[model samples]
Target: MSQAMRSEVAESWHRSAAAGVDVGAESSPITLPEDDLVEYRAAHALAPVYPLLDDALGEAARACDALLALSDHQGQLLWVTGTTQTLRRAEAIGFVEGASWDERLAGTNAPGTSLVLDRPTMVVGAEHYRESVRPWNCAAAPIHDPITGRILGVLDVTGGPDVASPQTMAMVRTAARLAESELTRLGGPIPVPHMIDGEVFVRADVTVQCLGRREAVLTVRGKAQVLSRRHSEILALLATSPRGLAGDELALLLYEGDVPATSTLRAEMNRLRGLLGEEVIGSRPYRLLVPVAGDWNLVRALLAAGDVVAAMRHYAGPVLPHSDAPGVVALRENLHGELRATIVASDQADLMAAWTRASWGADDYEVWTAQRDLLPATSPLQPLVRSQLARLDLEFA
Candidate 1:
């Protein structure tokens, strides 16, 4: 209510939160892996008409400093093309071939929400459900089978704020209708676009470095500044809450002793607003006005891409190691555990050694064992590893 969010968008946000989508998720999941993607795409109902769709939207998207994307009825991105600069930037959010734009998984987005509502739609900055995607704006319209009228896919134009205009949505809708007419002219049972089967983010304005520090170091507009512990905690809570939090909920997470008055939480928020500026925060259910990210985002992104070495390089200790706030504790442990699991699975001696040398990893029994198994008898790390293993055995005993 601090800002005017469209009713359709507001409803989508509530549905997204209800579905348990992660607000910090970096990108759409790649539902169409390489295995059958080529074959499936070649035979898809929308496949034959894609060239026409591209021609209709490609020039306009490029002119607008944006990319033209096509997604299946279930919201899997099948094609994404545009100028090299725009494509490169779009890659930061995995806005490429084979990624799913499903609302339940990727949250409220142009491609996903258009399919959900089965109509032309646009999503602008800060209206997005996930933080990493809040910087960009997009407009999309559903492509349908002319005979049956069931949705076949989505046609979208994604770029900066300029893409959110009514004109852009109208263009996309027109392009989609052209594709549908082409499909009608071609004429046949498309069949698989909707009925066939199942299953399954990047740059932000505000960056908060919550890892390896008690209080967060927030960087905005190219200046790095540290926030008070209270402010940092508030930021952390708001950053993670998918739908934002109510006043009473925030109070419960913040206080440890006897519950304080709601006025106390409001007073703290007032001070926080003064420090961070009013534009960065929202009310009703307290939320962030801009897309937010933490340092840990880099490490997880690397890990997910199968780059264990790069992931290890960016793993900068635990998140807010000293904070006892329930939400912070959960995120801290979950991130640490996820990273540790990925490291152990990699089974690379150098990677394990790198982790074992870190203070937090020194006491890790699983990693030490994995490292020991990978090392040779003459390895220089042998003696140190042996001593640590012995110390760990006795320490545990």
Candidate 2:
């Protein structure tokens, strides 16, 4: 189907689902779960994780006179802003990072419905599925990235349940537009786009700025870093590969049919290492800098896609920030294969073990659940997983 038609169907689904919530009114609100590991893990691992955009545009979203930013895609509230009263009301109605708003999970509401509809939307109180959601006026507008024009997220403004003001709707749209503008400004036209794994960087004039698939950078400071043609080409190559390249591999990628000497390739690596630093390359495996963790471009995609094999394959090595040698390419390939195979072989029981073994603060129920769901039933995992999940139910309950 055409993109437009599909989008229409999605929006229709949202509107019908949110039919009864009393959105724009003043009333006592509901309770939300405290910020905890379950909430953080789910939010952190969900598809379209917007840390980059959130970090960049949070201040503006908060400062907007009548706007709040939220993620409809994941059925979580994401972020909220505007007057203190409005925020309190929104929070009470279960619009937070960890709360589920899917019509399937939590009944009808703004975010889940908006995502189902794939369009901007407004949802009022009793229009909500749960009676607890009967107070609050919420209007939201979808925001898109200028480059790819994909729906990045929705901007929302919620107020007193009884308030039916048109200004609220207008304000939500305005905030969404402002957010779109900021996204564009943050990602500007670039002569050289840096592609270090998925940490894509676009040089404006002098300083290098990072970019993602959907957002733009427009600030003057971001525009100052202009990169050379070769640099841009090199960055792009590293960004797409499943494994890191050695000096010869990088040289082959950059040089193509031509055969560059080992020494010549070493010179380029040294120069790149000097400029980008040891953090971009690493002593182990002598690989290029391609961040596998934190807020990099591929991370959100990996989370959303929910393909652990692909994700593990992408993590070819410890994000080597400096080394590049011909011999290192083999090691990079081996690690990629190892990680993918390991994740593929893991079951829910193994996943819980992995989570248990992770750093104390990083053990997340979301990740544990996700890993569990992905395991094949025949993979010698079900019995052990059942036992662990049973234990978890008792512990959390």
Candidate 3:
């Protein structure tokens, strides 16, 4: 290795050793059990990108005697694909699914170091912190969610020292981009609003639906997990508070009148930790450690951008209709009022007509009246709009 390259590896090795990674260890740590591994992969939203990644790097693996691997942001190997001989070689080195390859577990290596550095990295033979893995070389790049700009995982090509070439690094980087592009195509465009100083914003892994009965469908990397009602409220509160909330503050936000016992809250959070992984929620001032895409936030951003139509599409319903928690109630009314006002204030007859027909707006007398007035006498919608207005008038009377 070049002197500069040796210095880089040495620095990483020092850090790994400090983190209690055993340099002389024979194998990486197995932090995930078989069942948990299945759940982890299933919950990861990036699973959809595997096929694209394989397609992009499969031929290279076949020709170069290399293995194409994908690991979650935590450095756990999610999938490994390559020739039978290469697979056998990787298995001998304990490079298999469910293995924790993070630098703290596996010592200095391409995938783990790339994650820590948040950049592309190459580790050649003898550069690996563990002597057991010193025979193999790997190049890896981090893949990020295009919508939220969150690191989803790493894409790597592993083989002999020949795989450490500039060309191999470029291939891994390109494959990472290809996977990200596929993710972007699937998620559609989510406009991130510009933030001024003192303003707080949070991104979500999935859209939180608080309308009616509170529920959240958490999608990370493409894997979806429908959160329980309590989990939905907990996530919603934390996702909105960028600086996080203390135990007392969170309890007040989650409960009404008498706050729940601290033990109850702790137990709930513990269960949530298991489902979301330990890295998602933090202690002390509890907060979401990752970006989340809440439907409420999307609506607010869309409305701010003057895209009322798009905002309406994202408005599933009121935010947590059953929750009487002060914060949640305030958020619910604010969003509901803003959206209704935007629709009523809009001059577009088509938009008013569209809103009046939706489940949320079906009973909106103002929108129905506006639609009635805007439609021509010969228009079929005029009759329906007028009838809706008359019915609303009778109910109010």
Candidate 4:
């Protein structure tokens, strides 16, 4: 019997292949050291939910000869339990605790794909991108932090074809919800900042979101202020440069070759200060008094730490998308270019797929080319890839 993948699963396979995953090759799974794994178990926020998750899924797992696995948001498997034979088989494939099963690492599978899709998913037979994993089927769903709605981890049930049905998917989804409910019940109230007065949050379209809109919101001491174009530009510059910029330097950076009048700049700064309170901005050279967190910084930090997946997740668009300010423009271009270059150089199909899906990379020729090159010649995506390449060729020509 010929096995066909569903559209979603097919797309996941395309993404997995593009990530440079070897379908026939068996790469050793990377696992945390025993000591580190122990610490991770202790510190993981989902630790408490384990008992409840086990209780909820244990009977079903035993009955179906399936394994119940839990992974962190990063797709690092933290726990794995099942019947004796199931455990033995799973361990051979590195489905043990502390192993990373991120799609980037493990290709298209239940837990990894669930993290990427942030929903319940079933990967059946060849739908598992790796040939070795195709013998088993699995259903998985992401668990979210109840308060922030951020993905905390994934819950998965893996076995033979029996576990690939919609019923199994529902079971996993219910288990995930139960885990989240347990987490919330035990977590007490969501922790709120003791003082919102001095703390400030700046949300730049590029920094706060992945859509890369050209707007910003500045919040201080629980009050929110929508920044004007000029104000956002100024605040963005100050936030990135902690050392401060002198009046002349600020004018040049803000206006490029045509510097704004010193008086105009001063008035704008005054208005901005009035809007955000006096303590938020320092006058020695224009700079932010309180630390500001932005998506751009988060991306850079993640990139520096070599977590390209997380970095790409945070990157929505170019910095200060509409800013023609000389310094802002330069900074924006540098960051954008660096991120693209890194993705291309990494040649991870999953990362490329992720980038191509973003607003910035939607039409990026280089990334698309990379994705096409990584795919198998007989892949279902070949025709689509060729069409995209042809269009790009004509457009560039």
Using lDDT as the measure, which candidate wins? 1
Q: What TM-scores do the predictions have?
A: 0.49, 0.36, 0.50, 0.68
lDDT of 2 at 33: 44
The per-prediction CA RMSD against the true structure, in angstroms, equals 18.1, 14.3, 22.2, 6.9
- The candidate, 2 or 4, that scores higher on TM-score is 4
Worst 10 residues of 4 by lDDT: 196-205
lDDT rank order: 1, 3, 4, 2
Query: RMSD (Cα, Å) of candidate 2?
Result: 14.3
* Candidate 4 C-alpha lDDT tens digits along 1-397: 1555577777677677666667775643766767877776666768788888899997788788999999877888888899999988887777888888887678889899888777898888777777778788999999876543456789999999779788888888998988877766776213223231111123221222212647666644324556777888888788778899898878888886767679999998999888777887888698877756665776776677676776676566788688778887887888898889999998676777778766778789888898788767876666777787788799888
Q: What is the lDDT of residue 180 in candidate 2?
A: 59
lDDT of 3 at 251: 90
The whole-model C-alpha lDDT of candidate 1 against the native structure comes to 0.78
In model 4, the Cα lDDT at residue 294 comes to 62
List clashing residue pairs in candidate 4. Answer: 18-349, 19-349, 19-350, 196-221, 207-295, 210-316
lDDT per residue (tens digit) for residues 265-308 in model 3: 89989999899888888989888887766768867877887767
lDDT of 2 by residue, 11-97 (tens): 333332322223332222222345542444333311233444445444544554333556533444555545675465556555655
Report the C-alpha lDDT of model 1 over 195-250, residue by residue, as the tens digit: 33321013455778787897898877446789878788889888888588999888
The weakest ten consecutive residues by lDDT in model 1 span 193-202
- On a 0 to 1 TM-score scale, where does candidate 4 land against the true structure? 0.68
- Model 1: colliding residue pairs: 26-201, 27-201
